[model samples]
Target: MTFSPRRPLTAVLLAGALLAGTAGCSTFSDSGRSKYAQGEGKPAEDDDASASASSSAEAELPYDIRPLLHPDKKYYGLAAKGAPASMKSVKEFASSTGKKPNMIEFYSAWGDSYETTLAQNAWDYGALPFIAWEPFKRSLAGIAAGKDDAYIASYARSVKTLNQPVAISFAHEMNGFWYSWGTKKATPKEFVRAFRHVHDVFEKVGATQVIWVWSPNVINPMPKVRLEPYWPGDSYVDWVGVVGYYARTGPSTFPTLYGPTMDQIRAFTKKPFIVAETAAEAGDRKPADIKDLFQGVEKRDDVLGHVWFNFDKEADWRISSGPASARTYREQSRSSRYGFDVTKP
Candidate 1:
């Protein structure tokens, strides 16, 4: 969930630069979204333990994550910075926005396990955690040929063990050329093979707890590249997560940034779509862009939810990036369309 190509930086420049740099509640991260989840473990609030008891390391999941990936349900939340080492720490962070996130997103490298302390924290808090499982180090061709099976298998086992429901966006934004697994490094055939292979292994391990998401960056980055070729088929994905950003100077409306990608995905899949990552730069139009984003998503029946990349890096992508941006975000998030509720009772 990053913004490397989030804005209107020409796609070519973004790909060349992202060899350079990088959401929402019903909650998002880019540039290794989980890169910031490195906080010291703190004791969960007194009730956090009890609240999450059902989603314990061994207990069966208490809720279904499939709905978040459905073509109709709505979700809203943030890609919070700074990891909370414990469920308590996660809860505290979730509350910082004055509203709990229903969806929590992060990133993972090849070696990280599927069921993490952070995942547990998120599940305990009643938020459905989504992971951008990257295929770094290992190429898509190698993954298609079982090169990362050991790592994939271990992660699959971990998900089965956790038993709680979560979403996994494997090799996200593959159409973009910036990352190793994207257009620059792998062909559409190789990407599909790798995706199915991973999904197959997960199936073998009985990791039904995972909701598969096939996320892509804005098509603007690779306008000439047809996204259809990367499709792993309807069976392989449960949701479509798209990433985009409003530029400080370029087209900063929801329609301009996300419309093209949506129009393309709809032709092929009926799966629900989620704004896996999006942010408006801290500029004159940030507030308006924020309004447009929420308003647009609210009116769309196909969009199930959106994840705001609340951090500030190349651009102040945070909700509080501008004076009224944060307030606008809150009002929009509280709207009826924003189906955020991590602490579901």
Candidate 2:
């Protein structure tokens, strides 16, 4: 779950900068109100005949993310520095792995404007944009009490205006104690309330295009803290994102790392899970660990995919850290079962 924190500078600085230039901007007014509203700001219902007609009359978009909702093949993704903004690192990763990633993962701090450029870049590159929306300076209790409604509403509207599918993993790795929203700073009840509140705001603004991913760090490191207490119910979650890493001191095999966590999750909900963040350490055993990572994902039907933490932080976790590891990654990840055209049906 650990990687170099490369916050998107352009994205944070130029929030909503694309709306005025993009063709989708035509559907919104200068006030940024959605055209879907009718009869003096009445919200449109899915079953409303007029609303249905309005939706059909909209121009066709290039990105179609339904395929990613229930992907027949595992998603090949990467989390690297300057991704979705530059894609230089992503391209290098693709070159080494012999295939372009179908999903791009990035981090977004709270109070920053939605990174429309990041989303656009991911779609333009034939990939899905996955955001790890971290509420760094904000308190979970204050968030739940609607103190941040204005900010949340503005952010959600930006996503709605884009009208493209995006996956958001809000306040990820909450089960761990290192982060502000984790066990040390916040309670499970407070976390659940804050999560539900954010999800509700997005729903109220008709940003239903988002795929809500509830991610938590693996339980192996913190066996004392249970994950069930933080559950925000099934309605608010579309995917269970599990975060873990293969380290020399930690669990090296997939079964030892993710099995117990997955087993505990199955006791509550049947939602499909993904290895949201993972990487192998740099060492002689990295090649074998890399092979095991790919093979482990390939054999699990419920595992949607994994996003490799391709950055050198704390340890050499990059895929190209060593010749043998790089070669093994290229060879093991060539499976036809790993990546697919997310834009296609």
Candidate 3:
């Protein structure tokens, strides 16, 4: 979903509850917002038992995910209306495309705790949970100055306790002017500082399970904005997520839409790329655009995969928007190289 100035009441209330809860515990008073509004973990046992259980769970799951970091196959992902929160969107996407997504993308505002249920559910369904962490409530300067350390540390600790591999795209699309952390609102230096600070906090908490994805909107629309200044360096990121769309007026082909951005990014870093957000607009060109998108990722060795923005927000971006588009998506997405059981790498 694109950035909107209007905040959701459900998300606001959820964040408020999280802020009011105890910071030291993994369990939150609320389950956060979800499509079906499911509960999170079971009631906490004694503090010692909870810690022991968390340790055992962490031991059961391997912390070293370097092997899966750069897999041979490209990952297919989806960002639907109610994603990681519930598998309903993913299941519907799978039914339409004939292949379940290897990565499930969702959005979370600042001050919200980690969605443990979402992570666990995605893992159980054989997909990796990808979070677009938006810092809507605070300024990048404030975050970099350690004003939000309490919340950041709390969130990092919760992630560590879960001990699941998660892909986080923090303050995404900073190169754009759409969000609070965007070009008009925050400087590039402040953005980089805040990004590195967040990464360091996660490191301090031993949340090595996270795959830090530094995402920026495709530079096609904003040719004047440079990406290097916003970059948090290679060590601070695991993947470069490029966000773009195939709209009716702008660049339609992959070369014009994402190629330039990828080219610019390559000048600075050789990190693997993921089309973090993309979808063709609903119209006569939708089917062809879908074909181009799948082919574009398939032919590239550096592009690890793509995450289709499956919502109908400004335009009908869903694959099932039309019969032709639906058929084309299912046909083009049938490539054996698209998805895999994330757990098995």
Candidate 4:
């Protein structure tokens, strides 16, 4: 369903009266009822009315998702080394070109002894580091269970030491069929709870440097189901992210994925958005496709930036340089995509 804006309310107050002569401990108090009514409290309600009202409010104003920013007008980020061996080479390429790699989506799972090596490499290269935490893997199962607050707390503390902005995408592509976060086909409410719980730990530890990117795959046709249940409260997200990959498998194009999905995400909240991940496969990464994606973004002030997934992990990446990826990057990097004059700004 397309999202509609919610109504604004004012002057909330408690409705119930206190019992003066109660000798036993009463579960519901006048202040408690009022707190629940105002959404400042979570009380067990026997009647569905109160619960329903609170649930509806949650659906509208869910969690406190953050806003992602780019101080530079045209944000240039590179994906370096899904594995350790490639990091040095990728970093060398970006440094030669004078662009600090904005963020690296490290494919390291939790508790890898080699992570210290990878983290050190990122620190030396001056790269913003991020990793996909795969707790569902057997070795990390306990951490994924949501019962391990201590585990999350410890990880948050460790990441704080890195002193670089880290985006810990626990289970990315949650809206896609691939990940266990949405593996059971959780309901939207369930998804919201799980997603928020992870953030709750980070927030509690005051890890404000961490910019949460709720990344999902672009809406797809059947045989490839889209899992919307994994969408947490807008409050839980810092940036709305979609992974858009172009393929010759069918009628898919960059526009077919990026444009409409951006529209769908923008329909509900005004949070800044990003093309969390992407790769093109079409002939020369057609200018028309690049134009379509930018046209969809230009007018909207809410849309912040796009991160071109810069890797050749897949055989169909269609990657090229201005000379090498010339046909593709040249047309794709036109000024409109950045929405600001890099020269002037």
Query: Judged by TM-score relative to the true structure, which candidate is superior, 3 or 4?
Result: 3
On the 0 to 100 scale, the lDDT of residue 173 in model 3 is: 85
lDDT tens digits, residue span 1-345, model 4? 000011011100000122111111112344444444455345544444576674554333211112124433434444543433357745554545434444555665545432545655654454445565654543223333576777677777665544334566655665544445444544445556666876888778755546677776666532244434556667777777666655434334445566566666666666667666554444544444445554544545555555544444423342442244534344445553353322112
Candidate 4: give the clashing pairs.
63-235, 64-235, 65-235, 320-325, 321-324, 321-325
Best by TM-score: 2
lDDT of 2 by residue, 164-187 (tens): 778999888788777788889999
Judge candidate 3 against the unseen true structure and give its global Cα lDDT, from 0 to 1. Answer: 0.79
Q: How far off is residue 141 in model 2, in Å? A: 0.7
Q: How does candidate 3 fare on TM-score?
A: 0.84
What is candidate 4's CA lDDT for residue 122? 54
Model 2 spans > 4 angstroms off: 2-56, 60-66
Off by over 4 Å in 4: 1-72, 82-86, 92-100, 111-120, 123-126, 138-145, 183-187, 222-229, 250-254, 282-301, 321-324, 330-345
* Residue 8, model 4, lDDT: 12
Q: Residues 1-345, candidate 1, lDDT per residue (tens digit)?
A: 354323233442242111111011111112211221222132233323443442342133222333344433367655756532444433553454456677777778777776467777776666777888877788899999998898888998887766566788888889988778987889999999999999999888767767888988888756898999999999989888888777665556677778888899899988878888777768778888888998888888888778877766655677766668877776766676566443331
Sort the predicted structures by lDDT, highest score first: 3, 2, 1, 4
What are the RMSDs of all candidates, in order? Answer: 11.6, 7.7, 10.4, 16.5
Model 3 Cα shift for residue 124 (angstroms): 0.9
- What does the lDDT read for residue 172 in candidate 1? 85
- What order do candidates take by TM-score, descending? 2, 3, 1, 4
Model 3 clashing residue pairs (backbone): none
